[model samples]
Target: MRQALLLALAALVIVSCGRRGPQPQAVEPQAFADTTPPSIIYPAFGDADPHPWEDRHPGHYPVHGLDVSRWQPPIDWRTARASGVSFAFIKATEGGDFADPKFDEHRRGAQAAGVPWGAYHYYYFCRPAHEQARWFIQNVPKGADLPHVLDMEWTPHSKTCRIRPDGRTVRAEAQKFLDILERHYGRRPIVYTTVDFYGDTDIGRLPKTEFWLRSVAGHPRNVYPRAIWRFWQYTGTGLVPGVQGKVDINTFNGTPEAWAHWKAGG
Candidate 1:
């Protein structure tokens, strides 16, 4: 009984008291698939390690999704989908060569489960942007339900590439990558970035580009000033049902109607 209490206390520290949305019943939480209208379903997931949000809590947003890599064990995409996981972004490739072994499995799993899934390419500074884009295309198949993402960030610990290019160079490379993907995929890709990288490169300067910003400690408005963001990655240690390990969690920046429209590629 004491051990149970200790476990409960550990879980209690990772709560979003700021979540001001309707929560599922504590007795039997509502499955997102079973929700009425299905457009606005807030899957009341837990966080293994959470950042207390003072405002703009992720739960307040009706739509949520997750990003997965090989670091995570095999995910039960059907279970995840039914549990308010409206979308998924799987890591596909990195640099010009290293393709994630789990990409094919995850992509197929998400598709079979009827989840709106897309692939994202992690940036490598040492590699040419065009080569990286081609590598991603080669690995991730065409005709996905969502736009692909370019994950550009500073790789400080990378042995092969530790060089930080100037804002101009970074912008140029990003544009090249974006344009190539758009031409090939017929959809403008979203750029996923973190705070420090955004601060250094000023990626928002890129023309006609959408962003998925990572701001775990605070709202995107507080971290990414003046930059319009479509998705906000609010936590890295989110605990969702059907996933074996902690995963990154994100929420759409719009209402159910807007989410439907956007996901329809409008």
Candidate 2:
């Protein structure tokens, strides 16, 4: 009887030891250092001064960034960084089935050049929000340093989706997309909007979500009028160094220290 009891105890000990939980994986810290020196002349768009939309002075916002898509020429991220571009939002996907062909190159190049980048999806009003959200999730990788964005705008002229949904329907669709992305990425997503879309959908009342407002003609305060904005895209015809053609210029709505805190996932 004593020998049998000893064997049973030994078996139990082995079983318990074998059932240990999985070990945690190590995550490498992301680099956010800006090494671009002052006095570096960025490329110009044309003889007309490519950046003519500088309604506000550079001293107003210490942190600046840009948004890019395939329409922009191949980017020299190193030069962009040196030109004081602190971050970038790269177009990753659109609609339900369309993925940006240059997404992989842009993502890899931005990281290699030490630029913090986020992916943005161009929302299609014709498609279901859940389907578009899943498509974006499948395309963009997890654990990105910056928050994902849903670029919503009035596509009255879209060849694909010309029909505009009602304001309530638009708001519901946006909510669904935001929820799905937030759950998958473990961070709240941003809603990018134009003046027309904001007025159409009344997106300013979205609960607990940050906004990236596009008001190229004037400050968001004057254009959006009482709407809260986190990032303000001031110009779409911006000329930055290391980038050919035109690019979109944007600024964070806070000081450099505040931007650092936000970038650190605060």
Pick the TM-score winner: 1
**Model 2 TM-score on a 0 to 1 scale:** 0.80
Instruction: Please report the TM-score between candidate 1 and the true structure.
Output: 0.84
lDDT (Cα, tens digit) per residue for candidate 1, span 1-266: 99999989877765655457776432212211122343443556789987777865677778899999999899998999888899999999999999999988898998999999999999988988999999988998888999999999999999888989999999999999999999999999999999999999988778777789999899877787666788889989989888998999898877777788888887
Least accurate 10 contiguous residues by lDDT in model 1: 26-35
Q: What is the lDDT of residue 190 in candidate 1?
A: 97
Instruction: Tell me how candidate 1 scores on lDDT.
Output: 0.85
Among all windows of 10 consecutive residues in model 2, the one with the lowest summed lDDT is 27-36
Question: What are the models' TM-scores?
Answer: 0.84, 0.80
lDDT for predicted candidate 2 compared with the true structure: 0.80
Residue range 1-266, candidate 2, lDDT tens digits = 99999999999999999897977533212111122233343332222233344444332566788899888767899988887888999999999999999988888889989999999999987889999999999999996779999998887777888777888888889999999999999998999999998998798767768889887667676777667678888777777888887788887777667788988887
Off by over 4 Å in 1: 1-41
